[model samples]
Target chain A: MDKVTEEELIGRSIKGDRRAQKSIYDALSPKMFSLCLRYTGDRAVAEDILQDGFITLFGRLDSYAGKGSFEGWARKIFVNTALMYLRKTDALKLSGDIEDARSLDNGEPPPGQQIGYKELLKMITSLEPSSRTVFNMHVIEGYSHKEIADSLGITEATSRSKLQRARLKLQDMIRKRN
Target chain B: MEDFENRFDLEVRSLMENAEEDVPSRIWDGVSSALDRKKAPVPAAVWWKRAAFAVAAAAAAAAAVFLVPRSTPDNTPTPGAPMVRTEVPVTAAPALLSEAVPSRPIIVAAAPAPAPAVVAAETAPQEMPSPETTETTVTKKDTKDQGQTAKVPLSFNKALFNKESRPKDIGRISISAGGNLQSNGSPAKMLTGFRYARAKAPAKAGITEVSESTYGMTLSAGIGVRYNFNPKWSIGTGVTYSLLSRSFTATYYDTSSPDLSVTGKTDNFQHYIGIPLNVYYNVISRNAIKFYVWGGGSVEKGVANKFILHDSSRDIRLTERIPGVQWSAGGGLGVEFAVAPNFGIYLDPGWRYYFNCAQPNSIRTQQPFTMNFEIGIRAGF
Candidate 1:
């Protein structure tokens, strides 16, 4: 079968073409599913978020104003879908100032021990839910502390504190692993 | 510490950029099935048009109340009604030169007690005889015995006298409260294509059936204000709370197995707030009795509904899919009796047809009309 263009697929999806919808799902679900896993830290929960995001994407295809890349638009939807899932599950609880937790050393890991991308991701998944979200949004996604604070309904100081606490925890985890 | 954190962030960001995994096939199955169950979008209601209709109806009613009565003539009393008669002196003949005036005095006849003294001014000239005739004029002896002035037959224009004798305008406003009884005018099919899962059956298997529906009698109460533009014509509007209800029973057979069947009964109640704009024309306006024909449209909103499924094991609450806004147009004939100057009672029989069905569900077909009868008391001012 010939591959349809993204714009054509979106138009057909808006018109409720089942084949076109399936095609859009096939093209985006892999990368979106991985993104969901990064946010949720569970394969099953990631799959659920992916399914909901795709459903919402197809349902609101008409809202895609064609001003930006469709992939970029779809990425935004997946991120929001992850956030909504977290909210629904009561996992996005913003409690205790990041400063209230005992601070850890931000020292370099013992020099000989090397950490790969896989090990770093595993370290991130182990942090508290709120800290994980703030760290991912601010560091990986390039969001400012103020932007993260507003989106998460927390204060800018809280976003900064969570990011700082997350880095300290990762340093400790990396030191222990090494 | 800073170097370790930088290294950790750099590694994780790179991992995230390259992370990808194949979506499981089962997710597609769930989505496709959900899509299959989705129905087409319902047609959107044009709210502005409905508002405009309501406004225009109210405006017409207001105008009818204030304007039409000015042009309409007042109620005319029957010719048999008692009237006061006065006699003119013979010296007044020159003043009676106009054709409308009588050259002779009008004789006030002695109508017995308890009888209205209606002067038959329309009676022909021969009926009056000559004013000087001894039989027609009161004799001097009788006038002296009664201690009253003598009366004589008078010639006058009957049409002018008839015009002047009409009853004065008795325009009034009526306030009424009534109970309305209603039933579907057409038969409705219910529980149509109802599907239930057999607990023991495999996934995606169920029983489907078309059921028979019978609606129970629905009763509504309403209060209204009516302006009698005249006795013969009026306009009215009122708000009513209506509770409509129906029941259905059906035998469902499992499609896959072909032998498993079960009978189930379901009932539902719908509550609506209906605003009706009506016009009434009295066909017969008598002293004690009146008959009128009325027609109008109503805007109704279904506020709430409840549906229950009854089986031997247990009753299950089913989700009810009710329409948000509905419009119905109807008319009827009414009869009223005026018991007092300010109070009357009435009964009305009418028919109404809903423009569309009240349910947004795909399973059931709807009957869009009802036969209604209402009775109530009306108070007028």
Candidate 2:
């Protein structure tokens, strides 16, 4: 027998072929989830987003423009699903003026003061969704200040200021414990 | 492009990638179930059949309520309440088509339906007994009424026997006090029923005045069910495990003894697992408790053995004795009483044989063969 091709699999999936869809999920869910974590800032949060995004993919597989890369398209879908969850839970309520957000001088804290990747997750999960999202996009996702603002429907300056404030609070928390 | 930014992104992603977090078990089940839903699409025909069955059941139950007389008085306070308007009849139809056919009649109701009579009796006045009790009374009455059904046993043998004759699925299993029956003399109407008369056998039956006794009666259980068969006849077979046993003790006179002593002593025993097959004639099936009896072959071949046991000062010694093949061939008369046209009980006096000798006519050299009896209440589908 011949090996199955990717394009054929995707086409079959669009036509309600469940096996094709499962094959696709199996092949791509882990990589797509890796990208999702950069945006959602937490593993559990990222998985929730991944599930919702896959549901959308199966429901609307017919709308693929076939122009942009499939990975890029799926990445966007995952980001949107995460944001949708945030929106439903009222977790993203950005209220401060743009001036309140500012870049801190201590952007590069001492190695020991800066929480390790694993420690940071515990702190991130504890943050309000607004703090987590800003911390995720601006610091973790490598999104520029302007991009974070545009994506979250907040001003670029506000995005920067929230990031600074979030970091400040986390630093205080780290200090009070040690 | 910022140095700190790229490192923060890396750290965040690493944290998120940690493999230690446990996923809930249901997540896998939910995902798999969702995937499975897309693969096997249920056919509309199956749904339609189920719906049709439901509708037909509802209609018939409504009709039974319109019919079947309520025997108990109106002004009675009842105890224990059963569901009143269920579609299940007291008996089940035979030859379980949807389910694998069981050897013993599987009281037909898969999931039981409430009998209108049981329900009527249940809510009659709170003074009336529960459907459970009503069901029990129905079974008890059925057990006692096997004689009436014989009047129409031949005419409505199949429908009346398997379909109409047997009771609904006995929900719970029960055991009863173990009983014994001992007798002598060969049955004239044994294998094929009471048809031919014996040539020189005693006229007043056999085994002059043997006693039917009970001991260790332990369990009692039952269930509620409804019954019906469509298009044609329903036949069923059942294996009865009654823990039934019997022993014989009598005078043993040995002229060969040195003193020609008459040592009044005896030794006899039998343990059997019986199977009954019922054939029904369905002319008046829906309500008639009439059918022919063509069963009593123990579900499988059996061996009836005896032991000459001697009581010693310290322990009793056992000497094994085997019987012949003709004795193991057991079948007999069955009479049923259909209470709800669908449910009832039966009394089977099956012919079970065991001789002192294992070989045919081998016992002729030793002595005459000793016979055993088994009579009990039978429930069918």
User: In TM-score terms, which candidate is top?
Assistant: 1
- Docking quality band of candidate 2, CAPRI definitions: incorrect
lDDT of 2 by residue, A36-122 (tens): 554556777767666655665564456555665565555555555565556545667765433453333365542323556556556
- The Cα RMSD of model 2 versus the native structure comes to 33.4
- Write one digit per residue (lDDT tens) for candidate 1, span B1-381: 556555656766766755678788999986676565443222223323332343355346533532343332222222443334332222112112223323344343332111111233322222333333223332232221243433333222221122222122135677899998664422232112222211111111121212334555666899998877765678888889887766654323234422223335656567778898999997755433456789999887777666555544456454443556778898877776544434667877676667755443211224344556788998876
**How many Å off is the CA of B299 in candidate 2?**
66
State the displacement of the C-alpha of residue B157, model 1, in Å, after optimal TM-score superposition: 56
DockQ of all predictions against the true structure, Cα-based: 0.13, 0.03
- Alpha carbon lDDT at B55, candidate 2: 38
Q: What lDDT does each candidate get?
A: 0.58, 0.40
Candidate 1 share of real interface contacts: 0.33
